[model samples]
Target: MVSIGYFLSCEEFGPRELVKQARLAEEAGFERLWISDHFHPWNDEQGNSPFVWSVIGALSEVTSLPITTAVTCPTMRIHPAVIAQAAATAAVQCDGRFTLGVGSGEALNEHILGDRWPPALVRLDMLREAVEVIRKLHTGRVVTHHGRHYTVEDARIYTLPEQPVPIYVSGFGPASTKLAGEIGDGYCTVMPDEELVRTFHQSGGADKPVQAGMKVCWAPTEQAGVDTAARLWPNELLPGQLAQLLPRPRDFAQASSLVGRDAVAKQIACGPNPQRHLAAAQQYLDAGIDELYVQQVGPEQEAFFTAWSKAVLPELR
Candidate 1:
């Protein structure tokens, strides 16, 4: 039996709404939660991006469901030591039900600090070192390091859970997958590509949980859902490294203009049909993902949860 989770989009909702949705998600039979960490929305239509650590703190008070950053970029903007401290406190708050999911990062978020975004290869190297720094701090011991990409001076995490928080790594390609296998307690990615999972296992992640997530739009009608998804998340259809390379929300919006409603509709499961939603999730399960997170895009959160609880979740559960 695969575990099913709800993905909270920080880019679309404010802190209060995210907490409320998390509560509703638990009531709707979801077993866990995946929250996105971003400094900016992918496009203007998505609207908001709250500080994720604060939102996670609020989530601790509201829901018991285990939470993980669908992926956070701990390499840039924020130092690994800071992320380590934050994750430690979050683990204690969540009663040890927290996982730290990190990635190399995208320019859209990292560029806001006025730092030049390094190439993907360099970022991966930074990610590896960052993971090491975080792990050392999580041991509740003072750490000092001078590495190629970053330097840490006498840093220690004071608040830690009884058990050390598990760190998961995310990847969209070969290099990152191998890194995840090498250092991650778990693995995360958006696509349900079995080939990637196989690579992860082969590289060193054998038997580790592989987490996957996807987005959908569920509304009264297929066209309504399609339009909503296209308007709010057309960036989903942008190909190649566009998602990683784009430096700002407007850049994404401009690039997304080329994507049509039909493309989004085809890419994302939409409408009232439970079968469509089930089939979408089934792909991840069949691909051997241990955890499956589903996000209902747009403003129909209530409808999406209500419908899924009654119709879709029962079958999947």
Candidate 2:
């Protein structure tokens, strides 16, 4: 059976609310957790981006559900060595229930440091090296390295879990998917593409866990759910590399303006229909996902949790 987890959107909630949601998710019977790591909200409308590590620390105190970063970009904005320390601390706090999910990041988050966002291939290479640096530091031994994309000088993580934190690499395409298979302890993505999952398995990730995240909007009415989703997460509908290429919340907003409500309604599971949500999740299960993380978009948190616990999650199980 595929594990069903709740996805906490840092872009839409503050640290305290995220912690509260983690507790609620546990009560709702979700088996695990996935939280987004971002420096900025995709648009001003989404309105928040708390430092993810701090939120994870709070989550550890509040819920026992295993947590994984939906994806953090360690190649830029933050060095891999620093990420290694933070992830180590998080793993200790979660009692070894934490996973560090990494990826070749989007310019919206990585470009905030005024660094030039490298091309896709270069970014993938950097990610490979970054993961190497992180793995070295997680050994709890002194590590020093000079690599093409990063340099670590006598760094070591002191506060670590009894075991090394499992690192899950995120991939949206073939090259990165293959790299995740080659180097990652597991694999993560946002889509339900069966071919991508197959590529990961064939490349080297067979028997490794594969996780995917999807969004739904649960409101009293279908149209209301569509409106809420379109207003808050239209970026989900933006095609191609736009999500990766856009550098600012406003840029995302400008680009997202082209996304219409009809598109979002068709793509995302909306409203009170349990079958719609189930069908959405079934796609990921059909694609052979080991874990499926679901995010309820907009502000109907209580309604969403209540409905999913009673209607959706039990049925999925």
Candidate 3:
């Protein structure tokens, strides 16, 4: 079955908001949930960044749906050993409904450690090492690692679930996508470009669950929805494919403001029509992804959910 899901926005909601959303999502018949792990909201105007791990912990108590950090960078700011431990505790708390989704990370989230952000190539290497480290520690046995990007000796996770948490790796372009296929239990991305999925499977990601996401704003008019998405997610248009670069959230917000609404609208789907919303989601399903997590961008969450559940979901099902 194609798993349908939603992305919990840490950028606009606090812990209380997340808990309410998680409950509503499960009650709405969504199967999975992904939450953004960020120390900073992309923009001050966007306003909200509750510590994600804490939010996830509360989610364990409130919902039955599985949850994952849509993508967290274990190699920077936080050590992979710490992530392994956190994942273990989270897995136990959630009753096996947790997945550790990882990525190379960006300056917007991971650059606060005062270290110069590495290039994408180096970040990929670091990501591999981080994954390896987390995997080994998840076994609940002591591990020692001395890799090109990480150094850990005698680390272990004591409170692990009976089964190790699955790790899903996120990628933006071909290189990281292939790396995710080769190293991850699954591949995750924002764009539903099937070619990227093909590249991953060709590189040995066969049977790996593919997950992709999109943002939408349900409104009375197409332009109204587009305008809301642009206002909240203008960062999508920041030049130079920033998913690979940029080290600070402040920088992200600043760069995003430099772009215009028309430019931001080109990347996201925003419309008043249910057909357009369904079409936007179809792009991900057609890409061979195993899951589609939609982020409802405007204040019309209940309406968006009602429309999607009534109009789009049966077709996907």
Candidate 4:
């Protein structure tokens, strides 16, 4: 049976609210938890982006659910060494219930440091080197690396898990799938596109765990859900392009406003029934996603979780 989880948006809630959500998720029987590691929120209206590592520590104290970075882009904004240290600490904090999810980040977040963002190909190369760097350090060995992306000497994770923390790679396309297969202990993605899983396996991620996420707005009726989704996720309507790729949440919001929310509603599944939610997840599941994470938009989070836990998840469960 496939495990299910939720996307805790650090960009949306306060620390107290976040802890409450974690407790609620655990109480609701979510098997695992995933969080966004963003530096900003898509809109000022959205209002937050707490440091995810700190939040993870909080989550550990509040629930027994395993935590994983739904996706953390380490190849650009932060050096792999920093990620290794953070991951090690998180692993320790969670008492071995943490997995590090990583990827090649976007300019929106990385460019804050005044560095030009590399093209996708170059980003992939940098990611490969970053992964190598993280892996070596995880060995508890003092590593000195002169690689394409980083340079370090005698670096080691003095406090690490009895078992090495698993590294999960996030990928949207074929080349990345291959990269994940080659280096990731598992894979994480936003869609459960099975072909992507096949691509992942072919690339080198054989027998790895897969994770996917979707958005929903649970209401007594479908129209309310649709309206809520339109307002919040108007970004879904933008033509598939780089704006969708910008790392800054404000950039994403700006792009969404330009594209308009009504247009995005056409693409999102803000439906009245379990079937629509199931359909929403099926595409990603078919894509070989091993875990499906759901994020509910609008204010009825408790109701949304109840409905999904009772109706939609049964089929997958």
Between candidates 1 and 2, the lDDT winner: 2
Which regions of candidate 4 deviate over 4 angstroms?
A: 243-248, 258-263
Candidate 1 lDDT score relative to the true structure: 0.93
Error of 1 at 96 (Å): 0.3
Worst 10 contiguous positions by lDDT, candidate 2: 151-160
Assess each prediction's global lDDT (C-alpha) against the native.
0.93, 0.94, 0.85, 0.79
1-317, model 4: which lDDT tens digit per residue?
67888878776776777778778777777788888887766666667878888889888898888888977888767889999989988999898999999888666567777788788889889988998898899899999999877998988789888778899998878888789889999988776577888888888777778888777777777778777776666665556446325767677777777765455455566755888888877777766677877777767878877777788777767
Better of 1 and 3 by lDDT: 1
For residue 15, give model 1's deviation from the true position in Å: 0.6
lDDT per residue (tens digit) for residues 9-80 in model 3: 998788997798777777778889999988777877678889888999999999989888888889888999
Predicted candidate 1 versus true structure: per-residue lDDT over 1-317, tens digit per residue: 89999999999999999999999999999999999999999999999999999999999999999999978898888998889999999999999999999999889999988998888899999999999998898888888899998798988777889988899999899999999999999999999899999999998999899999999899999999998999999998899999999999999999999998878888999999999999999999989999999999988999999999999999987
Give me the displacement of residue 15 in model 3, in angstroms.
1.2
User: Which segments of model 3 are wrong by more than 4 Å?
Assistant: none
Q: Estimate each model's TM-score.
A: 0.99, 0.99, 0.95, 0.93
Q: In terms of lDDT, which candidate is strongest? A: 2
How many clashes does the backbone of model 3 have?
4
- Candidate with the larger TM-score of 2 and 3: 2
lDDT of 1 at 179: 96
205-298 per-residue lDDT for model 2 (tens digits): 9999999999999999999999899999999989989989999999999998999889999999999999999999999999999999999998
- RMSD to the true structure for each prediction, in A, is 0.8, 0.7, 1.6, 2.0
Clash totals in order: 0, 0, 4, 9
| Cα-lDDT of candidate 3 | 0.85
